[model samples]
Target: MRRVKLSDQIAEDLRRWIVRENLGPKDRLPNERALQDHYGCSRGTMREALKALEVEGLLIMHSGPNGGPEVQQTSAEIASRQLRQFLHFQKLDFKHVYELRRSMEVALALNVVDRLTAEHLTALEDNIRLCENANNEQERELARQAEVEFHDILAEASDNPILVFICQFLNGLIRDLVDYRAGSLQEHEAFGARNVAYHKEILAAFKARDRDAVAKAMDEHMCCAETSMQQLDAAFYSDLLSRR
Candidate 1:
């Protein structure tokens, strides 16, 4: 069995302590010496623990006379990055990703349709507009990214925090796959046009608060998207093999 590092144990303890004491963002951890004394740890070990927590985004380190560790508000970006590192050695691929999307995206859309605010609706519309208004390759790439951002807006309308985080992480993976795919401007333009149409349809369903329509549109869009992404994946591998 692998042994856990002392710093890791201490970091986890600090995390639990923060939660138990109801410490939130901007809450300062006790000074290093105080923490060292409390944990019966040497100064160097305490410093290592604090540094580890800082790297995990659990704490922010301060400097000088008023320097110590402070709690920082964690974000989905941190969570997604951590997930990526953990899954890097695994054989997780686009098909596995879309399989998860197929099961969850439709339900999430239906759940959030009634909860979308006017601002959320406007953002969704803007996402589609970005795709349509793109006049160059760079702008079209941005527009393609906006296609995924459309679902992110809907994810935020969810009252469930876990659902929001999982969806954000999955979308992050999708964006990475999007970047890795090998395709020409023609293929990209075709995908972008499909994205615009789907987003427009989904946005209309959301505005009407039509749960059925939202579910149907989201499922269809994700299904079609999975096919597009798979084609891109095939092209990417084919190019790599040809080069070899």
Candidate 2:
């Protein structure tokens, strides 16, 4: 049978202590000597436990007269990075990822249609304009970033934190994939026009609060974008995975 390490046990105890005390991100952990005494562990064991927590992004250690380990609030970006690492190891391609995105985002659109506010609508409109008004390559890339942000905003409107994080993470993965194959897959001018049209259709459906229309529009948009990417580079998905 395997044995648990002393340091790991101490780490678990420290985690429980944080929870029991309801420590917030800004809360500082007790200093090293205090932690060692409280846990009845050696200095080396305390350091190991703290290091483990730090690696998991649960705590950040600092030094100097006023610095020590502080509880670090979990961030979606950190969660997304962990997910990306897992997906990378699986050797997933764009097509594989997009297949999942299509289902999730279609449902998310339907959920958001009735929940959208004027502010949300304005944000979506701004993103569309950002994409439509790009005058140069740099501007166009900014537009692409805005396009990604559009999906994130829509996901947020769903009022489901878990769904929002997942959709945003998928968007991040796609953006990174494109960045990897940057010069090789410059979108055609016509592609931008179609993208804008798709967004407008979806936004119009949301404005009308037509859940079914919003779902259909989102599905169509996803399908068209996937098809366009594949047509532009037949091996785009595989190329992205291979590059990584």
Candidate 3:
């Protein structure tokens, strides 16, 4: 078993305290010495704990005589970025991501099917146009990102905060995998066309407010995307092996 650092433990306690106190942005913590006294730790340990929180974006550390740690608004992007960074060191693969998405994204779709506003609908429609209009490699890359944004638009519409956060993170992972992998423009063009077709079907279901069709279409879409991602992963690995 791994031993936990005292500094880490205190940082966690501080996090819980912030939540319990309902602290908001710009809320200041006790002075360095005061916090040091409260945690009964040495100056080094206290500084490490405070720095951890700062790295997590939970607090903004100010220096000097008038300086201390102040609370900051937590962001989904921060959490997602942290998770993505961690996953980079793991043996995670394309299928691993899709395994979660195949089910979770379906739920996300159903949750937001009836919640999307006219603005949301417009954004979704506009995104498809962007995908179809992509011509160059740079433009095609942007289209791939916009494809992810289509789900992000749905994710933002869902009332379930947890669902929205996880979906947003998964979308980030998808973007990284698809954008960074070795692929021919011909392959991407095919994948892009397939994605546009699926998005169109999903949008039609949303417009008609058909829950059954939405669920069915979304599952099929994820499955198709998984296959395309598998091809990309194979190509990436093959290219890596050739270099050996």
Give lDDT for model 2. 0.81
After superposition, candidate 3 runs with Cα above 4 Å error? 1-3, 64-66, 135-138, 182-186
| Global fold similarity of model 2 (TM-score) | 0.82
* Deviation (Å) of 55 in candidate 1: 0.8
Q: Ten-residue segment with the worst summed lDDT in candidate 3? A: 178-187
Model 3: residue 6 alpha-carbon error in angstroms: 2.8
Query: Candidates' TM-scores?
Result: 0.92, 0.82, 0.93
State the lDDT of candidate 3 residue by residue for 110-161, as single tens digits: 9998899999999999988988898346577877888888899999899999
Q: All candidates: CA RMSD in angstroms?
A: 1.9, 3.5, 1.8
lDDT (C-alpha) at residue 118 in model 2: 96
Q: Runs in model 1 with CA error above 4 Å?
A: 135-138, 182-186
For candidate 1, lDDT tens digit of each residue in 1-244? 9999888899999989999999999999988888999999899999999998888788999988888999987767987988877875787667889999876888779878789998988888877787788724667667667778888988989998888888888888887766656352347777888888888998888888888888888899999999888787777777779999
Could you give the candidate ranking by lDDT, starting with the highest? 3, 1, 2
What C-alpha lDDT values do all the predictions have?
0.83, 0.81, 0.90
Cα misplacement distance, residue 120 of candidate 2 (Å): 1.5
| Deviation of model 2 at 28, angstroms | 4.2
TM-score of 3: 0.93
